[model samples]
Target: MLEIRTLYDGTGALPAPSLTKILREAYDGELFFSDSSSRPLIVGNFVQTLDGIVSLKIPGKSGGADISGRNEEDAFIMGMLRAYADAVMFGEDTFRNAPGHVWTAGCVHPTFEKEFHAFRKHVGKDSLHPLNVVVSGRGHVDLDEPLFRHEEIRSLVLTTEQGAARLHQRYGATLPAMVHALPGDAALDPSNMVALLHAEYGVKLLLHEGGPTLFSAFLRQSLLDELFLTMAPQIVGRSRTGERPAFSGPLELSPEQAIWGTLLSVKQAQSGHLFLRYRV
Candidate 1:
């Protein structure tokens, strides 16, 4: 069994109970979130090496599994977070990285599937799985990917006007996911995307599983409210620009504009992986 030891928890008292006892025990503590009414509460999850490398950029080994060394505890924590989110989102490149992956609690950690479903049900989530959201500014996505064809996962694509036109021209009504075009040519505004999810889909909690580029955009715009970071005990050195990428991507923040995060909770697994929660 995967075991997590809570090292510190500073999440102030909240009104709503988010996790079930089963999940709490497995996680070694309770989980809570402050409510947001203006826009969808956006949270990002990432696992990085000790040296701050998020991906090795290899042909077939670019996913988090390699970074976390296939740690089951990290997967369980990610699955638990997915259970709390109303929608799970990622950039197009993230989808391309994981070709056949599904953004659901059960898909990530089947051992805790029942507990995840029970928690979601108790929290009044109607969908069998959380909505899958993909952000593709240029619409350079492979529509035939397994996630697009998932019957249970209602997928939504946020794209630019030009990209939407391209998608319509190529896929038309045959496309299984809903494509929403926003006013832009290259990059869609993160705030606008959050507003769309909050106003249209009632997405109170959105989990961001990222490719570094998308994460840079969100972080630059200050759109991410919380971050769940898994610190894997590895030292993957990045020698080149494209081979190994940092978690911050290309958006360099000046000292004056640098954002600081407030630590909410910290947990450690037996395998020396650290799970950290931060309010940004």
Candidate 2:
């Protein structure tokens, strides 16, 4: 087992439980800052290389795993965050790339299934597996994917007016999920999307594991409350002149316009990778 060393912990004054114990079986651990259990507290999580390159593929695979070195510690931490979330929000392209993937504690970190469920029960989640949410502006998702077709899963397609129409015309009759169209004006608005997730789906904590475009939108809209970042050990050098960084899309915050954050905690894995949590 990899040792987890805490270099800092501004979020908690008390000594944190062992990383394994905390990752597997801690529910008294505060996961969100919101008072309401049915409202959304959006948190974004990602792992990026030291070179500021999130993916080596200028047109690479969509899942973070492909670019994140497939570190076991990162997966475990992501599973813990997923265990806390009421729903897992993904960009449409991300959902499409990981064809059979499900956003669940068990799916991401299966070794501690019993412990994860125990923690979920302690937190009072209605279901063990989180609801799957796809956020899309253009709504170009392929609804026929196996994820939506699975009977055991509950999915929400949050898309623009045009995107919703595209979905309804092609797969409305067959898609067994909630297809909600964001108000025409609020199509790309991340805050409005959070409001809808809370009001319609009763999501208290929305965990976003992304494709960069949607993650950047959350940052732009100031919808994110926290960021869990795993700084990977390798340097995947950026080659393209206009290559995509960790968070893609139109985001160029000058030093003054930059988002300020409080460093909540830092955990250093045995392999020298850093697990950092920030309250933005």
lDDT of each: 0.89, 0.75
Q: Across residues 33-119, which tens digit of lDDT does each residue of candidate 2 receive?
A: 444554588888888877666655534463577656777778878888887888899887777767778787778778767777777
TM-score of each: 0.96, 0.88
Candidate 1 segments exceeding 4 Å error: none
**Worst 10-residue lDDT window, candidate 1:** 239-248
Query: CA shift at 208, candidate 2, in angstroms?
Result: 1.6
Which residue pairs in candidate 2 have backbone atoms (N, alpha carbon, C) closer than 3 angstroms, thus clashing? Answer: none
The window of 10 residues in a row where model 2 has the poorest summed lDDT is 24-33
lDDT for each residue of candidate 1 in 1-280, tens digit (9 for 90 to 100): 9879999999878686668888989998888766799888889999999999999888789899999999999999899889989999899888988989989999989999999999989888888788898899999878888888887888899999999888988988797779999888799988889889999998999998888888888888988899999999999899665568777789898899998999999999999999999999
